[model samples]
Target: MNSMPKYLLMALALISLIACKTSQVSTTPSPAAGMFKVAILYPNGDDKTFDMDYYEKKHMPMVAGHLGSNLKFYEIDKGTAGRTPADKVPFVAIGYFYISDVAEYNKAIAQNRDAIIGDIKNYTNIQPVINISEIRQVVGNNTK
Candidate 1:
């Protein structure tokens, strides 16, 4: 048997093993459910004064501390390349919060309502577009 074929077989086996290990790790939500996701989207192409660094570093941590294990934050940057007749090139930011339920989500917001509002004011330099969503199902991971 050629050495090349032997090396190829070894690599294939290693890849398969890694894939199996990853698949074995579950990503399903835990039975003791206390999680939700919040998504925040910002306007497009304005580029006026949106301090993402401050929001991620200072504001998010503060909010997370207030909420504790009940919440998780996910942020996404959505900036388009150019402008168009339909306002194509928009600089957008999305933040997702994972909390327990609607009531808890509301409570968390209310608790940090002032700080949240202030952070938004400071970061965006303009009113931020806000949206709250309920997570019906998570495709992967079941742990926490």
Candidate 2:
């Protein structure tokens, strides 16, 4: 059997592509009205002890209970390495909290501040540097 001309075949293919369209999947990010807050605590001096096990098992649970609905999610990142593997981690550990509101976060924190502070001694000697940040989703071709 004889095939159509190359130009005609190409035109038909283009038309078929345009006609046979599929439903597009929504790639919208999850709805999160609240901001994300992170507090990174750096060790004050060389002589310090951080009890990771206790922090994960005890302290975080207490914080979560107090936080309640205000707390959307929480994470802990232990400083294991720096830019170079040989280099020491700048901070001892970092705490990330996705909160519904700043005021709620503060209130929860205020109510349990003493207990939280008290627990710190059980873990590490270093007083960490704290930082709060807003959560922003980067919407671009690179992001899904």
Candidate 3:
């Protein structure tokens, strides 16, 4: 009777340990879970007028007020070598915003699409190609 109780307690402890391990794995964010929407805007030419003014004055304020979200803009100076050669690289401007829900994102885009389009038309001489992308953060890198 004593041996039976000892074996049962050991079995229960093993089960509890396994459950805890599985729960930890399940709660962690997967590679796909970290995916976000990204937009890339390329300049028409060497024109600094549109890019500079739009970012500093018009676009930044409007995005902050309307979307209640901060925007991160990057100028693609150095290309990714074999992946994206310098010669092939367009004068690229990349914008990133956090979007957790697709439905909410689409709704916001719809609401502000026309205003953004108009602003681009008035400010930029070169039409920008907007590309939608799914972005995943690289592991073990300090993005902050």
lDDT of each: 0.68, 0.76, 0.55
User: Where is model 3 more than 4 Å wrong at Cα?
Assistant: 1-35, 43-49, 69-89, 141-144
Backbone clashes in model 2, listed as residue pairs = none
lDDT winner among the candidates? 2
lDDT of 1 by residue, 27-127 (tens): 75332233556666676544566777877788777777777656654455646554666666554566666666667667877988988787677677655
What's the lDDT for candidate 1? 0.68
lDDT string, candidate 2, 49-73, tens digits? 8888988899888888898987777
Model 1 residue runs over 4 Å out of place are 1-35, 45-47, 78-87, 139-144
What is the Å distance of residue 72 in model 1 from its true position? 3.9
In terms of lDDT, the poorest run of 10 residues in model 2 is 22-31
TM-score for each candidate, following the candidate numbering: 0.59, 0.69, 0.50
User: Measured by TM-score, how close is model 2 to the native structure?
Assistant: 0.69
RMSD of 3: 11.2
